[model samples]
Target: MRTIAEIKESIEADFMRNETAAKLYGFTSGDSFAAFFGKLSVESVLFYLFAVAAWTLENMFESFRSEVNASIDKMKPHRPKWYRDMVLAYMKDRTLIPDTDEYDTADMTDEEITAARVVKHAVADESDDASLLTIKVAGEQGGRRCPLDAQTESQLKAYIAEIKDAGVRTALVNIAPDRFNCELDIYFDPMLLASAVESTCREAIQNYIENLPFNGEYTNMALVDQLQKIDGVRIPELRSATTVAAGESVVTAIDARCVPAAGYFEMGDVKLNMKVYNG
Candidate 1:
């Protein structure tokens, strides 16, 4: 990663340190040689040559390093992130050539299957069963994450089975977003109308929930902090927060932080109790 200028400077320093070369070139000191190299005349052949050599060497070194790193990555065993990436890269209706484990790319273009893939967001984690991976996936619909349709889910499951490593099992979780409900107590500036403040605060809450990373943790303190940043809000308190996992009806309280079981969450029932701030 050394810049061309740095490499050139290093080469000049090494050349100047050689007393024999300096004496042969009739240069008495390091400053004299540096002055000659710093000139822009056509006679400064060594200076330009060193610059060219350094640039070429730096590029070669970088290319070699990249090739080595790529080789190492290929040799590494499959991990959680790799599984997530594979799931996202899955193309529907693609036939895997038997024993090769690679898709039949003959007469097929990438654009053909791009629209067939329904899974847009994915997260992979280890399951309770040994050698088993749990992958949660969701598709985008109207700018929101949603579960894949029955047909698409079945196609994805079959694809995973074919490409997964031997003896490794994968559990696909394609479900609706978990439901988030909360009640907040907000004391706001009287100058701003209650309705306006309430509207802005509700937007902030919705944004915070929707923007969380796939399977990201949700914390009560973080939500309160987000509300406190809004204008015209003096105090923000989270009265209660609960979530119902997708496909389940029981509500569970979030003590500190909770990760959505379905890989993401949506706003369910939010109640903002806006009150005027009295000093």
Candidate 2:
């Protein structure tokens, strides 16, 4: 959208280019409308009116462009990202109004529906079949990602069934966070107590794991780098790292980077072996 200043400048440029209009308006070729006409003059007043009209036109053009883009989005087929958005938008215990996908807002307030939306983080990806989509979602509980309650999970599944495109299958994944276990060797300065440093290091490690983006990658090197940032630590080494997916018994060693099967991860057994560094 053109700004009011830009519109006014364009008008002045056009007025200056027209010799006939400049002569009739008593404006010199080298002088702009603002330079030739006083603020309260008739010419200045008319020029301001033109600028306002052009500004209005620019706004209308922008509005029209936005409407066109929205229409295009509505017509496009639903993709994985769109499914993720739909999952996050699910409201618990709300029934869709007949013949429409939207809930009855008149019966329930917007704030109520918003509060009912429990899913905080979600990711959707295509399964082996192109027509099938796997969606992972979690709600925020105690400031960490967690699975929804049984009742809420049922409601969310029903909502997905109703809104999903025909011939497309959606599998919902709302489970406990994957467990991450790691052993770290920390070399700390002699000034700080090893116990205090160990406590802070554990907190730092928990924060780093819980704060990773949902469905984000976890790397051994990244954890080492995070541990090295703590004060009184000279060298931080990751001895071993392993993860067990939620509801699974098999553990997988993390060589470099591993994306959690569950959308997020929780702290498991973290062993901090602290050693005093004299050098």
Candidate 3:
């Protein structure tokens, strides 16, 4: 970047140097207006030139820096292994998913694609020579959580393909829904019932648990605190939250946490019994 002193020197050397411009000013050479202290008009003109030159140089540097930064971002690697950032950006592109704006990606494994909202991993065969890259998305379709049917998945695949390199290939696999049964015994203020606070608390807790990231840890204390945030719930408690996973009834204790193996959490039976108690 050019300094203010350098710009000022350059402007002073070239200011009003043309034949017509110099003749009209009655100036044979710029050396006559060297001393700015006595000549107020010359001093003001020089100051204005310096200001203009400084402004121009500053803007030039800013533009240059912006261009360099943009170039660096574009130069970033978009290889198959470096898939998170590129895939996330592609998923958020409005052109790719014009119908939906609520979905977001979460976890990702070496072999499987894990996301908070929707996505699935296809089983890879180690014996095969070729590799299969599969991604299944499920989200708000017709006001319900369902797989990104053939048409939507195809549209997303087209966009993803365009972003990938020429030799790379990706496959779209069908994702299965992972459901968890939750039973909540909540305590709240009955006075807030007029505002439907009880029902609101139940729904809020259910949504929070259901929408947690795929394979993300779920804590019991977090659920209780989130429930208490509802307007009508003064003191919210998560009485018992148990899930039937792999033919086992796994209970999430007050201090415990659990994560689903795949897919996002599904609300099985969120039984909320609100009690009026303020402690």
Candidate 4:
């Protein structure tokens, strides 16, 4: 049996040959690599090959487990329903969460979706009933060249004033610069800034705020927009959220996309440290 590295080496040999050929035949560097060539990059090809190997290994292990199960199933004539549920629960935690970037952008498949429903219920049983926290951030930074042109303190102060008028409470809004982006990070007293703003800033703030590069899964708050003037428009996902305690450093949640229907994520995915702790 070929080792995983051996199989990858074999793959690389074929990939190198094609790349060498394409380069020799004037395939420019900026050409669509996935189409004109094969993979997005050398790293992408390697990741895909590894994913295939991992999937293959998983299937092989499952086959072995089935043989074990056959022996056990034969001995147990009347297996309780709880026993079956326990077995299923064990497998759910044991299985590796699929590699999202390598397979699909959405990172979900049919099997994973059905598997998630079971996992969701089980995880729900373990929660301690926590309320969500919001951090309101300024969109500008002083040192870094900002993503947007209006990145001054005055611009941010003005924006906050308007955001407050739009029904978001920015009274104690803690703002700071992210070292890399040099953008002001905002955390609300509560975590639902965009949702609150959606209610108040029905007309004025809609157009401008929509264009901001946000990370949350944004929807138009108008189940019925109370005013006729604020009809039929939606907000994009508000990205780059941060949270900070009094005198403590800011922590930003990664993905704040909570579909009210999918009880799976009441809040978003959060990382306490991207730099110091991630180190």
Candidate 5:
């Protein structure tokens, strides 16, 4: 991290050392000295020297930085939690939707890939021969939280297969959809006219609950706070916030937190059943 002035000073000092060496060898011509050492003071020549020295220093610093980073990374734990999260992040953008070509992603816009998410689960079991590792991946996309089609799922499975350890007797890749429907009962003020309610309230609430940070537990307090902020809504209460599979039975009076069994949270419709009351 030497400053420009420091590096320039060092380069100038080097030029002076070479000038002194020339004088010691009887090569000094007071009139021609300007032709030799004067070149070091010339703006263009000085700039060139500074540039080369700075570039060499920068390259050396980069190599040292990379080595230090590598050592730090190696010293860090390689436990499953860290590895799983790393795999999940690596697969997010690397994954593809059904029937989409690999090159198509480069041409595709950001909006097209905004909803993509990757969830991973590792299971170890002993079989007849040796221990086996089974990695399950769930890829979700779009508003409805649909799963990747067969083709894309296969491609994603192949993409992650390279991370398997050699000691594993067998490594299997499991892929599926992670769509979860969230049912909620939100109470509102009766004085507020129904017509005044925003048509996008359902969408808003859906986005709020859905967009809760990945691997985060959904809290009823957060959801209620967001719902209460809506127009024509007051004293919002989540009577029920049950997480269920798509088309599955919605358990009433269950835990308000939508805790994911796996890492991904494929949010479904808000299913807000609004009740109006004076309280």
Candidate 6:
């Protein structure tokens, strides 16, 4: 199997890494953080700074891809309107470009096809569950402890029901990770550490749910006082990440999954808010 670094490189190369695309999906902005950042109130000056940073980086990448596509079409000889049309097409498809000399791929043969199929099955162990909520509450005391409460369970059930309208199934998978760090003094600095921890746990819990086998892999989770908020913690990962299907070829419906999630909760004079999603 390829090493983690190799897997990361393979993904990068698959996208035809230009510096712009690299920055657009930079390492610092992990998938989880990118999702949370987007839902922030950009109207606030503090949050607006992030909005500018993300947007500026975004435009830079788009401009670079546009120029590359434009050049590729101009250099190749094709129908009068072909160059103009194909550039847009090429921009949308990451596999081809004016700069890719070795992009030439030969037709697949029986042996190559068989080998590909084998590789797929080798790494095919994964799962299915619709909705998962990992709620961590702040406790006046700090050990890893909290059990499902009636009010908490009902609140999350309502949240899950709302999402059911979207044709998405959600099953709450509760995990009790080591509770909040009370001594860390969340009040000292806006609960940045708590927020970060909250982000990580939410992601971990969701991932655990998605990989769980359907028969009976999960039970509802709950906690107290670590994140003292009544509504629990929230962190949204994406906004409208999926394109609605229209059943038309030219419409070119995007098939990628967009999971935008948010986690919210509060602790000692501070609140934890985070999101995770990739478009």
Best of the candidates, TM-score = 2
| Candidate 2: pairs in clash | none
> Cα miss at 178, model 1 (Å)?
0.1
Q: Which TM-score value belongs to model 2?
A: 0.88
Per-residue lDDT of model 2, residues 177-273, tens digit only = 9999999889999999999999989999999888899999988888888888999989998889999998899999998999898888999999999
lDDT of 6 by residue, 1-279 (tens): 334334433443433334554476563322333332343434234434544565666678889999999898656533313322222122111133244422223565656544322111000111234243222221112322222345544553453343222333334432222111111111212334545556544444434433332211222222222233323234322211112111222322212322111111112111323433222
lDDT of 1 by residue, 1-279 (tens): 776667667767777777887888777546544576545654345666777787898889889999998788666667788889888878777767787446666676667766755678999999655677899999998988899989889988888887777677788999889999999999999999999999999999999998899999999999999999999999998999999998898999989789999999999999999999996
Off by over 4 Å in 4: 1-38, 80-279
Better of 1 and 4 by TM-score: 1
Stretches of candidate 1 off by over 4 Å are: 1-10, 28-76, 97-117, 128-131
Best by lDDT: 2
Q: Rate the local accuracy (lDDT) of all candidates.
A: 0.85, 0.86, 0.55, 0.34, 0.53, 0.32
Two-way TM-score contest, 4 vs 5, winner: 5
For model 1, give the RMSD to the true fold.
Answer: 3.8
Please give the RMSD to the true structure for each candidate, in Å.
3.8, 2.7, 12.3, 23.9, 9.9, 28.3
Indicate the residue-level lDDT of 85 in model 5: 51
Local error of candidate 1 at residue 108 (angstroms): 6.6
The list of candidate 6 runs beyond 4 A from truth reads: 1-141, 173-279
Cα lDDT of candidate 5 equals 0.53
| Each prediction's TM-score versus the true structure | 0.80, 0.88, 0.48, 0.17, 0.52, 0.17
